[model samples]
Every structure is written in C-alpha cells, then in structure tokens.
Target chain A: MPTRARRWHISWLLLAAATIPLLAVVSLFVGVSEVSLAALLSGQDGGRAAEVLMISRLPRTLALILAGSGMAVCGTIMQMLARNRFVEPSTAGTVESASLGILAVMLLAPGLPMFGKMLVAALFALAGTSLFLAILRRIPLRSVLLVPLVGIMLGGVISAITTFFAYRTDMLQSISAWTTGDFSGVLRGRYELLWIAAGLTLLAYFAAARFTVAGMGEAFATNVGLNYRRIVALGLLIVSMVTAAVVVTVGMVPFIGLIVPNVVSLALGDNLSKSLPWVAILGAGFVLVCDIAGRLILYPYEVPIGTVIGIVGSAFFLFLILRPNARVA
Target chain B: MIELKSVSKQYGDTLVVDGVDLTLPKGGVTSIIGPNGAGKSTLLSMMSRLLPMSTGWIGIDGLDVTKTRGDVLARRLSILRQDNHMTARLTVRDLVAFGRYPYTKDRPTGEDKVHVDRALGFLDLQPLADRFLDELSGGQRQRAFVAMVLCQDTDYALFDEPLNNLDMRHAAGMMRLLRRAADHFNKTIVLVLHDINFASCYSDHIVAMKAGKVAFQGAPDAVMQASVLTEIFNTDMAIHEIAGRKIAVFY
Candidate 1:
C-alpha cells in the first residue's frame, strides 16, 4: 500500500513537473506583440523578437513562476502555523498591511528605491501576520470557519484604512493599480525581486518537516523536541517575506496560495516535505495558465492576472467551503 | 529517578498543583490516580516540562528539566497527552516516524526505520501503517499514537490519561503494554489514571492526589484500601479482592 501511494505521488509529480515548462512556453508566446517561435528561431525580425523575449516575455514568465510558487508555499506555511486551511496572505491582512506599508513609504519617503519599498512592505507584512497570530491565540472560539473570517475582517479593516488614506492623498488610482496585481508591466528590472521570494520558498522546503510537525499542535512538536515557538516564528517570517516580495513585484495575486495548496493536499496528504514540490509546481502552472488566459481573453488588451485568479480561485474556495467532506480544523 | 521539589502550578490566584514534592524511582510503572481537579495531569505536565512550574524544580535523572535543552531531553524523555488535535493529514507510518526527529531531525536512516517497524509491530499497527490517521477508528488511532511514543525509545515515558477513549479490552491491553514496557524494556512509565482498579492491578507504585496534594503514596495494597480510596475520592467505596488483585467498587 505504501509503495502504491509512493508510485501515485511520483506520477502526479511527473505530470506537474511537465506542466510548468509547457505553460511557460505558452505564456512566452501569448502576448500583444507577436513573438512567434518561427520569428525567434529564424531571427526573422532583426533581433526585435529576441529583445522582446529577453526584456519582457522571459521576465514576465519567470515572475509568474517565481511569484506563483512563492505565494503557494507561503500559504502552505501560513495554514500550517495557523492550523487552519482557510487562512492565507490575502485573507490574513498580510497583503493589505504590505500595501499600507507601500502607501506609507510613498507618502513619507517618496524618493525611496523599489528595494527599500519592498523591505518596508516585508516588515509590515511580518508585523501584520504576527498580529493576526496573536489575535488567534486570544480567540477562545477558534472554529474552522471563524479563523479565516477573522482574517478577512482584519484585511477589510486594513484595506479600508488604506483606502481612506489613498483617497485623501489623491493616490487612490495608483494604490488600486498596485493592489490589483497586473503583470503587464513586468520587465527585466521590475520582476527580479521575486527571486528572493523564490529563495525563501527553497528555505521553506528545507524546513518543511518542522512545519508539518509544528502543524500538529504545540504539545506534539514539543514532545519531538522542537522549539514550537521558534518554528512558528520562522514560518511567519518566511510567509511574510514571500508575500511582500510578490506583492511588491507584481501586486496582489489572490487565491493561488489558498487554492493550489488545498487542491494538492486533497490529493496528497499534508506532509509538507513530501508535498511541497507538488504545491510549487502546480502553483506555477496555475499562474502561468491564468496569465495566458488573461492575455488572450481580450486579445489586444488584457485582464489582470489578479482578476483572472480571483475569479477562478474564489470559485474553488467556495467549493472547498461548501463541500461535504472538507477536512477543516 | 524523576524528582520534584516544591513544584506548584498557579493559574492566577488558584493553585492547581501545590508544592508537589515527590520522587518516582526509575524502571517501574507508576500510576497517579486521582479524582477531578486533583492536579494529576498538571503534575505530569510539569514533570515532562510541557508546562512550566509556578515555583520549584523538577529533575529527570541528574538533568534539570527547565535547564536542559529540548532536543537533549527529548532523547531521554517523552510525553503524550490524551487529546492531541492535529491538522496535518499523515499516514500512520509517517506519524510514527516523527519519533525519530530527536535523533534524525527528519532525515530517517536505516536504524530509524527498524525502530519504526518495531514500534508498529509492538502495537499491532503494521496492517494500518499506510492508512491515513483520519481514516482510522478511534481505538486504532490511539494505538498509532502509542506506537509513535514507543518508537521514541525514551528512558522515561509520561502519559496523561492514556486510556481515555479506549474500550475495556483495549484499555486493559494498553495497560499491559505499559507494564511490558516497564518490565521488559526497563523504561520508567508514569501515567495519570482515573481508573483506580486499573492502577491497583498494573502499577508497581501508586500515588493518590486529592485537591492539589498527594493524599497517599505506596504499593497498590497500601493505597487501594477502602478508607484511603474513600478519603481521596470523597465517596463511599468498598475494596474487594478478585483473583488476588484489589478492586474498588463504588456505586
């Protein structure tokens, strides 16, 4: 039986592994400016196709893969730490607090570089996630639904404050643009920060077993000689840093984190060490496909990746909630 | 030996375990039997270093529990609580393999696999080793948890109400398993038990607590008396010897 399970996981991993490159190729070719395979291979367009591939298409594709996998892994860690399936960066106010930090930097340090802005946003994300965890600890009635509901409420409150400030400063339009998560403007310089998020994702993979044990409540981890508090703190830092990097690079890509991990866990179990690779691959594929659809849906124009995933991810989230056999805690 | 010196646990103004000073000798099954709110579980938690003592100190062997590093102590001692709520969906093998974390840090070797298999065989969990924990019956799940604890291979094992959700037969089986662990493996086993009869039957030493203090501590024959049992539980109880084992009957 264990061997059968192992074979099943390997096949799924193989399928998932094959999917990302295919989607990346598709994403590279699907865009407003036509950069065909023939054109790139034959050098038929005087290196313009090559330039576009390097400057725009390749970076955009890399950003999608990096941000997608990063966010999905972030969600996995957050769910483990929170010990609830429904919690994610978008629901937990981490993204919103990151936006608030960006807003603060825009208003206070207008000349700050993009890296500086990302640093501040990551700091705020860390603080926001910690606050959410602190609140969860105080909440005596931590029903499965109530945890995410509390996170959503916290997000709403933070976004509302952000909106109020943006409205006063006449920066509402820019803030909306930043929060909506469009990858249309991703180029060589803009999307590189997501590599840091990817690095953090690798770190998460290294620490996956600890997170799995930590997910089994504090007493269980302590019995195994894990410093429970330290593991949780490390999980939060990874989650927040990933969220901030993705948000800073490409805005808020909602539900990829929430949906991808949930779907993977449904098929595979929640042993993060075994399942994280699947989560990362599936997440990248999901985002790449969504980005391609967003580009092709309106042809010359594009729907934002956030809007596309928001629609698809929310549908899955609702299904997860409404399903009879949903394993929630 | 497990030594407690003036150990107390206070929640606000209320003290749950009050200055519990006792010594449990190594290499035998010790049962802590008490009624509700007697702090048996609390004392067990403090002894295992799962809960910080309000005042005083606890030592296992020569190492102070509060001062010892977690991973170092983990190799020597292990504890299991009655209600272990986990969100991770794991196979029985996967769960039991976690017992090797103290040594392997999640990277299991050949020797660790041997230990895991032995534990599964000991608990008769080989058939269900591949099954997910949520797919198991309550008793099977309980056995799986016990297998994980056994796989830890610690010198001292502590359990808070190990038989909470077991049927009578399964509860007796669990008691026998603990007894065998103490007798064969030479492990120090301590348990918090509400069943006085089980305590009387299986334990080498019995300690009865009442209202945050130890009311009696001795062999089963000394602590299982009708007078001492009635005083500890505050109920009318009669002792009857069945097959040379003391049994308490309270109606």
Candidate 2:
C-alpha cells in the first residue's frame, strides 16, 4: 500500500530553507563590531573579533531563531486550538501569566535558578491558558472579531495584576525590562531554555494532523475517534511551555506567532503537517530581519527587538482586523 | 442492533428526550421524522454517543456505547451534526481522508486511500475532490460531508438534517445514495429527516416522535397513513398510494 504522497511543495520549502541561512549569515555581520571576513580569516588581530562573534553575536542569532520559531509555532497551535486566526501567547494571557510567575518567584525565591524560574512560569502559563479556554467555552463566539478582543481583555487583566504587584514591591523597573523582549541579553547560558521550546515545536510537528482535526471542533474530532480533549490539552501544553520559554529567555516578542502562521497559511493552505516547516522557517527568518532592523536603526545604541516588532506587528494586526474579508473561516 | 433501554436527556428542568426504550434492526434505512422541537435529533445524538443520556444505557451490537473505547466505537458507528463550520481551509479530498483517521491515525495506508476514493465516488464527488470545501455550493458541501461520513466505513451511520441546505435534486440524490448504501453494503443507516415525503419514499422503516417520545414506529406504509401523519403533526395530512408507494401530502 503506497501511502498518500506528502503535500510538501519542494519549491517553497527550498526557498524558505535557503532564506534562513542567508538571513543568519547577514545577521552574524550586523552589530557594533567592525570585523571583516578577511580579518577573521587572516588570524592576525588577536581573536577579539572572534571572541565577540562567538560569545554575543552567535548566541544572539541562535536565540532569535529559537524564540522566533518557537513563538510562531506557539501561535499556530493556539490559533488552531481556538479556531481563531488571531490567537497567540501575547493576546491569550500566557505571556502575562508567565510574567506574573516570574515576579512571584523573584519575590518569594529570589535565588531560584533559571530553570526553576522557567518551570514556575510554564506552570502559571498552563493555568492561565486553561482559564482562557474555560472562558472561551462559555461564550457563544459567533463573531470572529470578538475572540481576540476577549483574549486581549483577559491579557489586560492579568497584566494589570502583574503591574500592581510590581508597583507594591518597588520592582516595576526590573519587571518591565524583563518583559520588554530584547535579544541584547541573550548570552550562552541564559538562552538554553529556548532549546526546550525548539523541542516542543518538533513535538507539535509530530502531532500536527491531530491538532488540525481538533481544530475542526470537538464533535468533528471525537467522531473521527481522535481524543479531542486530550489533543487540546497537548496543544495548550505546547503553547504555554513555548510561550514560557520565550518569555523567560528573551521576553515577549508579540506578533511573530500571529503573523508568521497567518502568512504561511495564506501561501500554503492550512494543512499543518505540510505547512509547519514553512511556519518555522519564516518565523526564524522574520525575527532575524526584525532584530537586525532594530540593531541598525539606532546604530551604536541598540533598539530592542520587542519594540520593533510591536510597532510593525501592531500595524499588520490592525490591517488584518480592518481588512474587508477577514471573516472567520 | 442499536438498543436503547429507558434512555432520556434533560437540560435542567426540561426533559428533551423522555425515558424511552427502543431496539433498531441491524441493517436498513430508518428515518426518524418529526416536526420542530420533537427531540428527534437529540435522540439520535444520544444513540450515537454524541450526547450523554441523562439516564439509561445504549448498546450497539452488545457493546455498551458509553463504556466502549472511542476508536472501537468509531469503527462501529459514526455521526454527523447539522453544522460543520471549519476554520481550516481543507480540500474535499483532505476532508474525506480524515474519515480514515480512526484506522490510520494520521498515517494513511493504501487501504485508507481506497476507502476515501470509494466514498468520494459513492457521493459523486470525485470531480470536486480537490476543490476547497468553502468554494463548493451548499449542496456540494453537504455531499462532501456525507462522503467523509461514508469513508469512516462504520457499521452504523447517523446524520442530523442531512438535507438541510440541499435542493430537491441533490436531496433526492442523497437519499438514493443512502438507500443504495443500505441495500448494497448491508449497513444500518439512520437519519433525522424533516421531509416526510423523502422518508416515505426512501426509508424501509419510519420512526415518528412527538413531545420527546416515540409516537409511531413501523414500516413506511403503516406510518404513512393519513390518520397517523395528521395526528402526529397536529395538522391535515393526506396520504395517497401510487405505484405501490405511500406519498404524504401535507400542503
């Protein structure tokens, strides 16, 4: 029995695959350093350029790929699970919940290791996402516009709580900086948790078809013998853990998840198993482009990637909202 | 046989499906017909395990529906609800392929492909198999969904309002296909149909419900009588025999 041919479009796959390394190479060169290729190849200038490249530039680039692709995958999974195109960690309260968890851990266990902090954040994220889904189940959800609005409001409530606590504890500055989503602080050891997020993205790839069926709604999924609730739980777990990893490691990069998946689906259709690779590649490529833009925009003074994405992402999001045909599928 | 023992469903104080016992024959076209709010769809939902019975138990071929593993039951029975609005953009072929998920679990074997192709052909959907579902007309979309259910290849198949958006031509075609499925494959086909004429013409047995209880059940000829139809529907219904078939006229 020959299996149905996988719907992998070799042209798009190759193009996206090729774009990532090109962006990575360009990203490796964009920074405060003035190290030419000839200088590095000569081995003449005492390895200062090599040290800076290895320590800061390489780690930063890796962090961008991991966090970007991870968040995009998180967005894709959340969107599918919610049956709304606008869902992502930032909108869905997962990021705020992670921030709240980080703040709590800072106050309660100030000396907790990074891994422990990520675990706490991930747990809180899972709880927050569950609450969101519970709220979603109660509503009629007839309008497509209402879904993201509800999510944004939920996020606002959680963010307000986090801000209140930060204010009372006199740690608003630290908390705000942590949540700003800058890649400048992504050192070798600090960005390792995003690796776990990368692994979760792979798990999402393996479970893509189940998630697609689950996205068709509970009855459709259950009738086909897929465990709808279990699949939804798995999706939420992946979404929360990935969001937590990105939030802890590099802060919240808002719209990468929402936009990348939307763009990929627009071009390639919604067969998740076939489209996930493109989603990952485009996600990484998009972040690299944005990070480089932020770095070069201010030259010696680096602008945060979060601020850059926030501006561009919000504009694109508004376009989606106001677009004449953005009706719910 | 699909057997229900004192099955009932309630929402708070309102009992949508009253405690009723029923035993459906193993293989035939059985159409459940009722007016608005007759609990016909609700009863079908419970029998197929799509909705939990407030009390009592349902057994399909001696296996308790509530206790059977979902995959096992999926191979035995499949049900489709009225509304199937999907956010994902899926082609008809992709949608039908999902019917085999119970057996293949995402990895489609050549056998699964055969089932999908056969189901598509059964519904005459081969020409539009690659077209996106949203792009199809309402009647075409209904056929696509029926194709998916048929591709599930279960022993018993149930549908709620399968003719809701279909035109007369498509509706009649759908009924003929369902009748053929029962006759050729020896499958138990159950449907909640609003059109009494369609039921009278295509169904081997008819079950009529009123106010949450079964009012009549028998061969189509017996239930299609003017007295039974008028009483169950609370209106004037005239039954005429033509070419040895009972036709109901309620206009």
The residue-by-residue lDDT of candidate 1 on B113-184, one tens digit each, is 999999999888999998888888888888889889999999999998889788898899899999999999
Angstrom error of the Cα, residue B189, model 1: value is 0.4
Q: Per-residue lDDT for B53 in model 1?
A: 92
Give the clashing residue pairs of candidate 1, or none.
none
Which is the leading candidate under TM-score?
1
Mind giving the per-residue lDDT tens digits that candidate 2 earns over A1-329? 11344434666588778988889888888888776677678867888778778888888999999999999988889988998999889988899999999999989998999889999999999999889889999999889888888888999999999999999999899999888999998887889898999999999999999988887788888898888889999998999888888988899899998899988877666778778888899899999999999989989889899999999899989988888778844
Cα shift from native, residue A52, model 2 (Å): 1.1
Instruction: Report the C-alpha displacement of residue B28, candidate 1, in angstroms.
Output: 0.7
What TM-score do all the candidates reach, one by one? 0.98, 0.97
Clashes of each: 0, 0
